[model samples]
Structures are given as C-alpha cells and as structure tokens.
Target: MAGPGEFELIREYFSSRFQTGAQAGGVDSGVVLGIGDDCALLTPPRGKMLATSVDTLVADVHFPASADPYRIASRALRVNLSDLAGMNAEPLWFTLALTLPESNAAWLEPFARGLADTARLYGITLIGGDTTKGPLSITVQVTGSCDRALRRDGASAGDHIFVSNQLGAAAAALPIVLEEYEPSEVQQQQADAAFYFPEPQLELARSIGACASAGLDISDGLLADLAHICEASGLGADLKLDTFPIAELAQSMSADAALETALTGGDDYQLCFTVPAKYLDHLQGLQLPITAVGRMREARGIDCFLGGKPWQPRGTGYRHF
Candidate 1:
C-alpha cells in the first residue's frame, strides 16, 4: 500500500475545503484570489494599511507530536492571528505552508477541517501555499489591515502597561502534559483549555488602537514580551506583582511557582500594551477586562516590585536555542 500523492491529498483535504467570499456570503471581500492561484491577491480596504505576519510551528518544539491534529491546526492559525491583533489589524486572509512526513488521510482530514473552521470563524479566507515532504511543520502567513498600526516603539515613559486577560494557565498546563504533575480534574481542564484554545483578543485590540501606544501579544512570558516593548521604545517597566491578573490555575499553586509561571512560562497568547496615563480614563470606558499591571519608566530595563520592594523572578521565557 502506498500513501496518497500531493495533488490527491490536497484535493481531498485542503483545496476544496477553504471557503471563498462567495461561499461566506461575500464577507471575505478583501480576498481577490484564493487557493489554486500562483500567488494570492489581496486588496486592502480604502485608507487602511496592510499588516502581514508569518509564524511557524514545528512538531515537538511548538506542540507535542502526539497532540490532536485539530487542536494543533487551530493553534497554528490562531497564533498568527494574534500577531495581527497586536497591530490592531482586522484579519483578511491567510496562506498555509504545510510539511508532512507522509500523506495520511486520517490525519489530514481533521487538520483541514480545523483550519477551515477557524478561518470561517474569523472571516478570513485561505489563499495559497505549498506542500512538501519533510518533518511535520506548519507555517501560516496572515494578512490584515488597519488604519494605524500599533507598534512596539510607540510607548512613552509615562504610559501605563496593560494586559488583556489572566496569565500563566497555559504555562501551568505543561507540567500536566509532561506527566510531571497530577492536577485536580478541574485544574487540568482549565489549564488544558488555555493551552489548546488561546484566544487572540482581536476585538480588544481594535478597541484599544486609538488609545494604546505600543503593544504585542503575550506568546512569550509577560516579562519577556514586555522587555521587547521597553527595548524598542528605549524605556523600562515596573510591574506591580500584586497587580498581575494571575490565572486561577496558577493562583492554585505556591506563590513562588505561580509567579515563576506567570513571568517565564510562555504560550499565554494575551495582548500586552501601553496606554498614555492621560488616556487611562478613556481606556476604562471601553469596559474590557484590561488590567493595569505596570508603568513604563525612563530606565532601560524591567523591574518587578512587590509591596514597594524589588522582587526577582526565576526565568525570563522560552528560547529557541
């Protein structure tokens, strides 16, 4: 018995499944040309600038090889969307470059379904991409449009740093996934859900575009990702430990362990951004669950403080090397 060939695999699993503007009730208006084209064609909305980002997920490195194909596919696409969210861009379309060890219909079927389901949910159409034989990996290029992009270098010294949601639940799930820790059933469910289905916070991003000066998604740990803004803006930050909207799963752990996970355990996928102090009232008016975790400062590095005293965390975040 032989595995399916590339074209056959695509026909059955990918090519025909991706929705078009016509199929989506003309919602995907920005997609000029989708799959089967030599190159995707996109038209940015009038007066809006295009925002593009690419992200790759490797087997075992980004997710466990034994993970469910549906969840993995969803995560791959969602993470790329998070990048656009950081720039306050509305997602338009995406391209996928998938490498597989071999063609297995059982695996590809659910994977494509997951990808299609997520794309439709966000009103993004699948454009074009490549398929090749290799180790399992997925690379997605997402294109979005915004009138003015939120950038890392825009934060000012007096701005207040905010995060969209609670942190460290995804990080806390790692120990359970590795069998290093046996959590209670409720705790396990909470952590696993956070790890597998992290939300991109697109609506929240759009609402803050005019108010936020600098921002990025918290794929890396909070401290590490915040450092990126500080480095780009030539400023520092002071994170109030007590102000962290720590996830309930992490809060269940020892204080030191929870803090460590919140600081260094990556994969949270929340938005971390800075708003000018003057706009704090405006930000509050949005009524989003945004938390003011810290303040940008004139210094050149990040400082953690607990009860007016400086505190140090164990690690920064995940590193590729």
Candidate 2:
C-alpha cells in the first residue's frame, strides 16, 4: 500500500467513518458541523447544561502496547464516556486526537471500525481533532448535556452510599491482561470484557437523577474514591465491608484478598453515589443494581467495619505521581 498522508488518513479512517453517526441524529441533537473542518460547531440543547471531559491514554501506561487495535479504541472512547455518565449527562459529541508511530492501513482500519462502532452504540458523534506522528497515544474529549447534573459536593450526613454494581473486576483482570496469570477461556473472556469493554453507567446515572445527592464514576479504588466524595461533601462515611458486591473475576481469590482488591484496586468505572435519607426510598424504588454499602456521617473521615469490627485496606488507591 502507498504511504498514506495525514489528510488522506483522516478522511479515509475518521471523517468518513464518523458520518454514519451524523446521519443517525435526531431533530434536537447537536452538531452544525463535525469532522472535515478546522473546528466543530455545536448547538447545546436549549435548557440543558453541557458536561465535558478529556482523557489521554498512552501506550503501555493505560493499556498493553501490544493489545488489539479494536479493543484499544473501544476502551479509549468508553472510558471517556464514563466521565459524562458520572456527571449524569447524556451523550452528545467527542473529539479524537491520535498519535501514531506510523500510519499502517491494516491497523487504522480496525481502530476506526472500533471507534465508529462504539460511537454509534453510545449515540455520540465524532467532532474534530488532530493527528500527529509520535509514539502511540489516544486523547479523547467528550461533551454531553444534562438537565440536572450530579455533583461531588452535594452529600450530607445521614445520606446512604451506593455503588452501581460489583467492583474490582478490572483490577483483578490486570494480571490476566498483562499475561502474568493464565486464566480459563471463560475467565479470559471476563478479563477481556472488564479491561476492554467497560460499560459507562449513563442509564443508571439518569435513573438516579434528582434523587442522588452526590456521585462519581469509580476510576479509582472504592475507598480512595469514596474519600473524594467525603472530601467534597465535607462529611465522613461509615461502610459495611460485608455488604460489598464483589465481581466474579475477583471471587476466586481469597476472601481477604478479594475484599482488599475491592477496596483499594481501581479501574472499575462503576458509579459511586450518595442518596439523602429522604430520597433513599425513591432511589431504591428504581430497582437498579445499586446497593447501599455505607452511610455518610457527620464525622470527617471514612471508616470501615467488617464483622462489626474496624477493618483496614492494604493500600489507598492508584497514584499517578
């Protein structure tokens, strides 16, 4: 194949592929101009607020450098979308900045397909971005809209704490992802899904809506992330360790090991939120996969109880520094 120039590469693999999403738009959806221009023109809904987030994933640091191109694209976009979900926002549009060592058509084809498929599934459009020659890295900036956005500082004492679903799967899957541990076929599938196709909790956040006092997606460990909520809300939390919903991927580990991972291991991407006492019943009535594992307190720090006794985790959370 001929060496693809930057403009041709963008046209073939990005702009053209992203147009499918534009055609699927509704009357109220935004996007006066998208890819092919120097900038994207957008129209936010009349009364809705825009929620935007950006994430940069470098090769080896975020995912395996030798991983599948398709899965890489999926993980990259979905993780950014998780941020919008954390803020209780609906998907709108996103920009992609891709840095590559070389423009290999074989690689770009699958990567583009993966990105387009995910954008299509999430109902988000590809706006505009830049391409550069460098070591592999993907930077995605997503913008969404919301009627009533969730905030980190909205909790108070006597509020119930909840997580959208089971935790620690992505953390537990790291070993399998790095090939440090060999797993059964089913276990391997579980690991791949956890690490590659993590679901953004958009619907659950939408369901929680006005009833949620505070919320954030669990990119960090449960305890570490819960501390964020505590810090933001200016309150503490008392958690029941026994009530944690562990993921099946981590269930095969020793009980203590599993609990430790669930508490300190990061990358789950599920939503951790608080509901005031008065809204507890309303939140529960939604019948989501949420569980109240703790309660916000008047104290200024988070405390954990296992078997009715104080418990501690091995670590706080992942530190980039």
Candidate 3:
C-alpha cells in the first residue's frame, strides 16, 4: 500500500484546507504569500514590535506517541501560543515543520483539522512549513505582534509574583495520561483537559501587560520558570507556599505531594509574572484568577516559605538534559 507523495499529501491535507477565507492568498491574514512558495511573506503591523517563538514536541518525549492526534496538535499549538501570551503578544501567523515516519491519511486528516481549527480559534494563519520523513514530531514557530511588550528582564526587588489560574494539573495528569493510574471519569476528563488542552493565558497577559514588570509562560514549572525571571532580571523570589492555588486535579494527591507538585511540576502553561506594587490594586480590579503567591527579593535564588518556615522540594523542575 503506497501512501501519498509529499506534494500530494501537502495539497490534500494542508494547502487546500488552510487556504480559505481571509488566508486565501493573504487577503486578511497578513500573508502576502502562503504555502507553495519558496518563502512566506507577511506584514507586521506598523509601530508594533514583532514577537516570535518556536517549539518542537517529539513523540514519546514531549507527549505520548499513542495519544490522539487532535489533542497532540492542540497541545502543540496551545503551548506555543502561551509563549506569545507571556510576552503579551497578539498571534498573527505560524509555520509548521512536520516530520513523520510515514504519510498516513487517517493521522493526517484529524491532525490537519486540529491544527486548522486551533489556528482559527486563535485567529492565526498557517503561512508555510516543511514536511519530512522522520520520527513523529511537530515543530511550530509562532509569530506575534505587540503594541506593548512584556519582557523577562524588567523585574526588580519588591515586585510581586503571580500566576494566572491554577497549577500542577498537567503534572498530576501525567500518571493518568501514561496509564499508570486509572482515575474516576471526572478525574480522567480533567486529566485530559489539563494535559491535552492547556489554555494559554493571552487575555490575562494583555490585561496586566501594562503594569507587569516581567513575565513568562510556566511550561517547565513554577519554580524553574520563575528562576528564569530571576536570572534575567537579576533578582530572587520568595513564594508564600500557603497561599498556593493548587489545581483540583492535583488536589487528589496527598497534601504535601500536591503542594510539591504545584511548586515543581511542569506543563501548567499558565503565566508566571512579576507586578509592581503600584499595580496590585489594578490587578485586583480585574475579575480573573490571578494569584499573588510571592514577591521578588534582593537575593539571587528562589526561596519557599511554608507556615512561616523554609521549605524545599525534592526537585526544582523538569529538565531536558
């Protein structure tokens, strides 16, 4: 059984499907040329800075290889979109670099639909990409624009730290996702949603961008990701462990374990940002799930205090190496 060739696969699955509506010949998607050309032409909005990020999710590494293709695509795109959100960037377009061991339509149909649907959901267009024969992996490079850029190097001592929504759900869901644990139906659903459809905090980032001193998405985990802001801004943080908003999915675990997971687990995709004291009232005015759990310090590393005493985690966070 011979599969479709490269060009045929592109036409059937990607090109024909994405080249519709405003994206048709770059009418409204800011594309001068999309797909089938040597390069993609795009127009960045005037007076706004361009922000771009790229991520590669390898099968069985970043995600379970046997997971649903649709969910995989959604997780892939959503996490990348989180990068834009952390920087308060508005997503404009993206390029996909898909490497597959073989071209299978059963996989391509839902995968392409997943990509297309997520793109539409985010109001981003697929401009161009490359397809190659290799191990299953998806690499997406997202480009966004920012009228006001929130960077990682702007934090200072006395700034407060916050995370959008809850944390540790995805890290807790890993056991269910890997079939190591069988949870109740509701827990299973929560697991799937947390791991497969992690929401990017774009609106929250935009809401606080004007006052947030520094920000980044919590892909690696709260402690590890916050360390990045510390390193970049040359300051440390002290987290109020008791005030931590542990996710319901993670709450099923033991109290100590859940808190540890919330602190050190990865894939939350929430925003961990620093805010000046001046904007605390402004942030409180918004009806969002922003939680202030820490404050930047004059020190050089993260400090965790629980019950007014120092606490430590078994591990800092997920490490690729």
- The per-prediction CA RMSD against the true structure, in angstroms, equals 2.8, 2.7, 2.6
What TM-score would each prediction reach against the true structure?
0.93, 0.94, 0.94
* lDDT for 217 (candidate 1): 92
lDDT tens readout by residue for model 1, 1-321 = 123566456644576787543342254366666665556666668887889999999998888887889988898999999899988899887888988888888888889988988887887778777887789999999988888788999999989999988888888777665556778999878866787778888999989989999999988888889999999999999888887787887887788778777777688888999999899998898899889989999989999888889989866423321
Model 1 residue 77 lDDT? 91
lDDT per residue for candidate 2 within 1-321, as digits (tens), equals 123576466555676767733453555567777776557777788887899999999999999888999999999999999999999999998888888888788788898999989998999888887788889999999999988888899998998999988988999898888898779999999999999999999999999978999999999788888999999989999999887999999889888888888777788899999998898777777789988899999899989999999988765322321
- Which residue pairs in candidate 1 have backbone atoms (N, alpha carbon, C) closer than 3 angstroms, thus clashing? none
* Alpha carbon lDDT at 67, candidate 3: 86
lDDT preference between candidates 1 and 2, better one: 2
